[model samples]
Target: MALPKAHRLKSRHDFQAVFREGIRRHSSHFTLRALKPAVATEPSLDTASPTANYASTKIGISISTKVSKRAVVRNLIKRRITAAFYQLLPKLAPGWRLVVIVKPTAAESKCGSQQFLQELEQLLAQAEVLNGHS
Candidate 1:
């Protein structure tokens, strides 16, 4: 299954912000970019709750043509990566932006979802984005 809309990063600006300001964590097949939410400049309307606008963690997956010329292969990789994230969602911290980039070697290696999950968990922990990491 795919991620929920609220938990998926859909904008080009959001992805670019993460890529520009996020910290990078790497594994053999993937690179994870993670950024904490930016503080709001304007005052929130709800005076009673300062974090009313706080959001859950949002993620984006990017699979380049360099990973595979065929769309099928790239999509398969994306699915595996998404599944991995879906399983880990409950354990992740909130209000973070993340992007997962698939490296070319992943397609060549033909890794499975379990491998993706393990590597992803490792990367998240390394980036200190996992819950309880702080």
Candidate 2:
């Protein structure tokens, strides 16, 4: 299943903001960049609800041609990444904008979903973006 719209970073501006302002965390397979969304900088105006105070995490996945010259491989990587994120969403901290960039090493690894999930979890932990982590 696809993630909800609120859980995705869809626009170029959003992606650029994350790239420009986010903190960097790296794993063997991917580099995770995350920025805690600022209160004043929120792009969405649907903030009157009490639940809106607790912003949902938004994620973007970028797989460049350098990682896989074939679009099919790149798309597969994207799907896997999204699936991994979906599994981890509830456990993840809220209000952060995240970008996961697949590295060449990741493409070469040809890891299965479980291994990809493990790598992603490790990256999230190191980035301190996961709940119950210091």
Highest TM-score: give the candidate number: 1
| lDDT at 69, model 1 | 98
| TM-score of candidate 1 against the unseen true structure | 0.90
lDDT: worst 10-residue window of model 2 = 44-53
lDDT of 1 by residue, 1-134 (tens): 99999899999999999999999998899999999877778876768867644679999999889999999999999999899999999999889999999999999996799999999999999998899863
Off by over 4 Å in 2: 39-52
Write down the TM-score of every candidate: 0.90, 0.88
Off by over 4 Å in 1: 39-49
| Candidate 1 clashes between residue pairs 3 or more apart in a chain or in different chains | none
Cα lDDT for residue 122, candidate 1: 93
User: In angstroms, how far off is 2's CA in candidate 2?
Assistant: 1.7
Error of 1 at 51 (Å): 3.1
